[model samples]
Target: MAERKATNKYYPPEWNPKDGSINKFVGQHPLRDRARKLDQGILIVRFEMPYNVYCDTCKNHIAKGRRYNAEKKSIGKYFTTTIWSFSMKCHHCSARIEVQTDPQNRDYALSKGIHRVLAEETKNDTVTSTYSMTGDEKQDEMRNDPFKRLEHLQEDKEFADEEKVHLIDLLEFRDRLASADYQNNSALRKSFRVILGLLLQNFCKD
Candidate 1:
């Protein structure tokens, strides 16, 4: 883990000044609790310990007195987009720790080990969905069934070739999720969750 410097000397090409505005999407919903649990592994409480501080290198005790700056940034490549906080400067040492926080509740600390847990859950979801697709044999059978085949063909004809390609791209995203090694990567896991959520939301709407 890199040290969280108070000043960001350089911005990566992918960084966007406008990306911060996306945090407004968080809102109250029946699904919000479930989503938070899926991402963080516990039901988030409103009134709890606000911020936790730790030495980044040794993971030792650090003074809780000093306040560090909180920056919201988008991370992960594919299936996730986490707007998480980066805490800098341990009072005990010059170490910096990066922590995950709920965008809705900026002060609360998500459980320490929730990232890998969520990643595993996401992997299982992808595997289950893929397995349900039933391989080429079932697809062939579906093609042979008169009514089902008509419906399938009708849907294909209704969508342009580019739209069909986009659908394939979406399924490929599932493949990416299934293939990822989430054990060592909390950030990747977060990104995957966000991507999966966005893809599913778009798919359901379509």
Candidate 2:
């Protein structure tokens, strides 16, 4: 039985690594926690693109709504969080794209060559913007760029947060809350609790 078992063992004949049956598992290693470990040595984050990105060279599309295995790099540090830059190469054209983090608004902006399409903006608007951009101009209209200038936000500045929020929204929330009688109305009580919970949640996070 031992002799038969030994005889049944199969070894490759000469140099036959290309053989499918024997080489199926060869060089096929599964990576564990690849998304988290993609930052390599840097303590960066990993996120999939939220929108499709266009490759300038090949005129191809890198679809969004999925994790592209792209590594997010830290460009600078804020009070408690680090400002990040997410970058990836276009699959078709191999063009490098860099998207930076917006500090104040907690959003992202294209630091290099890419654009996010909003529901409000139309195809014509994008076409006009493309035509208007002559020399690979950077886009950071709504972005909070800390390195753009030497001073902090003021009324003279263009991208100022303007009291940290719009006045209309402040008035609206204030009016709604003022009208609500939480002591007498069950709905108002529930809403008050929910709003209190949200405030606490955001405060703890900050």
Candidate 3:
């Protein structure tokens, strides 16, 4: 068994040192089965799905990170970036699926036998905007009105001042909590114990 796994491979009768290497002498690629499609410029590769997709034939969900033994080949070029295509079969059903690299969009695209599962946007998913001008009309009106601009500037300054005061208060509160005087207090310790006991009671009830 150890001999079978040895790095020193047994050379065939026809193999000669002048022939360069055993793989070249036998006219077989070092990758063996993986290089079967070498003539066609395709190589067998282990590919993982970049995003969630539904198998078109079976209508089954093939999740993102699902892996498959796929045939990988260069399909095209996108500004010096080589676009690759991966062809694989769905494990649920023997349906062929083709995925291609989308360099322009910096993502992957389904070419055949699979449909992308697009997540629906929700209110919570929407980004919270920072500015008060929620629309183009309001922005245009604000730009035209000097008084509104001055008011906006005043509001920004007030908000900044409030935030600064709040941050300072928080830091002072933290400092007070961390003080040696606070740590040495038996009254605070008893209060904390009572609070912890109440919390535990509430947690156990839940």
Candidate 4:
């Protein structure tokens, strides 16, 4: 009798469609904690194989295939929203990794916690560095200063030239609007009204 043919069966690994595979590269960074407070109560844990996972105590890369533990817990509140904190422990060196994510959006980035006073101070510094005076106040200063007045006149000339070009274009458009006979056709009049509104908006922007 002929020998029975060998039989083989193959089975594919199980995968969940809802929760996809974790990307270790993106998850390795500590999540921002401030985001959790701004967002509602949702959080996402991301994981990936580390290209450079240095040990906290020894400053060496954590070995691959080693198991690590991650923990998430509610920390405190910012305003009415609750903040959550996460920590990961390295299996080799007992190093603790910490990150924070927004509770509202799992992908939201965490921001540094700064009070309103500090934020205002920071903005003030930025404004002072970039601009010497406010718009109307600066114009008044230029009026009083001869050298600044001359500079302002030159700027005004440049602005007038740009406005002249825009006016020419607007005149051409008005000619087209006048040439179109909308008196006999109601639809044409409606279309002209829409175009006129757009042109007026453009003029306002200028």
Candidate 5:
């Protein structure tokens, strides 16, 4: 029964050893149902959401890492790399969503039926609760208040001057350490150690 089951694959009347592989003779793809649209150059695949997106038709939120059965096909090529497209349906509203590979940017782009959720939208509000001013807030304050902008400019100038002084001090310290006399002393000490070790070995042998 096992042997019969193993050999249960159907073969058409024209099928023969000389005709080629069994899949070619049977007019079926090796991937079976996954290649149902092989004639159209598309294949069924399991695709995961690359990032958060909102369904345009139903306004439903699709989180990143969500998996779906998608249709995949090579749409074009960027140099030697082929760009692929994935088309899937949203679980909540059954709305279609299409995403394509952006080979140049090394990311995915939404082709249709969906909108991406921005990083700022997904960020927690509590993250900015601290009193320290962020770059954006500082820039906004500087733009609105001339006095604040002038103060910031003065602070920047002071900081740059301090950095320059520190850099000059470091260069002086480096120059002192790398002096010709220092290099000669270092080499002399290294040779003295080698000579002392050889003398100690001879004394021990004697």
Candidate 6:
């Protein structure tokens, strides 16, 4: 006699679809502890290239406004608290840099880079008049600015040629803003929209 085609004829009713497989569902994952792959135990974290920092090895610029691969490592623990440090490598020179969270001062300190660049902190904001986004929400807005690739203030031949950004603030504001000093000592005299435009400019440093 011809053998009957093999099939799941003897499969358990629970293993067959529409045969009450839903009740037998087990919440198991194909992968284990996926968050641990990110770093430590945090599933999500943020790291920024804060300044137009120069690579020590190649003297190339690792400019601000871009995200890089970062590793977070715990240095110590105070009772139940832990100190974390964010480590980054210069894409150009492979020079390593670090910034650490200082819970005592409630600030961050960079161990290996010249200075930090203050970046825009805006977005397709809704309900600004009635309710404002705060903290991480506000920050997320700026980081995702839609016009960051548009014209840049740093591209102004007048300003780019004369001014330099420094640790505390602009290094040569006297010269950089001299032309606009009469306009209330402002380096920029444009409208609020223009101000927003200036803040989001992506000045590529290559």
* Model 4 ranges with Cα > 4 A deviation: 1-144, 183-206
Cα lDDT tens digits, model 6, 7-53, are: 42344445757544433444323333434555344332458764455
> Residue 153 error for model 2, in Å?
26
lDDT tens digits by residue: candidate 5, 60-152 = 899989999999999999999999999999999898899999876556888999877875643232245534545666788999999999999
Q: Where in model 2 is the C-alpha error above 4 Å?
A: 1-40, 43-46, 117-206
lDDT of 2 at 42: 41
Q: Order candidates by lDDT, high to low.
A: 5, 3, 2, 6, 4, 1
Q: Candidates sorted by TM-score, descending order?
A: 3, 5, 2, 6, 4, 1
Which is superior by TM-score, 1 or 5?
5
Model 3 whole-model lDDT (C-alpha atoms):
0.85
- Candidate 1 error regions (>4 Å): 1-49, 56-60, 63-65, 76-82, 103-206
Among the numbered candidates, top TM-score falls to 3
Task: Kindly indicate the candidate among 5 and 6 with the higher lDDT.
Answer: 5
Give per-residue lDDT, candidate 2, residue 27. 37
* Alpha-carbon local distance difference test for all models: 0.50, 0.60, 0.85, 0.53, 0.86, 0.56
Q: List, residue by residue over 1-206, the lDDT tens digit for candidate 2.
A: 88887886455565365665443434331443444454463433456775666656676666776555466666787787878877777666667877777665445666776665444542333324522432212235224465542343342354446644677689988888778756448887789999999999999999
Model 1: residue 192 alpha-carbon error in angstroms = 71
lDDT of 2: 0.60
Number of clashes recorded per candidate: 5, 0, 0, 13, 0, 1
lDDT tens digits, residue span 1-206, model 3: 88778868779998889969988988888999998998999999999987788999999999889999999999989999999999999999989999998876556778999987765622132346775324557667789999988887898899999899999999998888778675668778999999999999999999
In candidate 3 the C-alpha lDDT for residue 7 amounts to 62
Tens-digit lDDT string for candidate 1 (1-206):
25666555545566566764223323335545434543443333322223333444565644333455433343432335355444444445555445555443323343331122132332223324522444566577887798877887786687667688898999999888777757437777888999999999999999
Q: Supply candidate 6's per-residue lDDT for 90.
A: 71
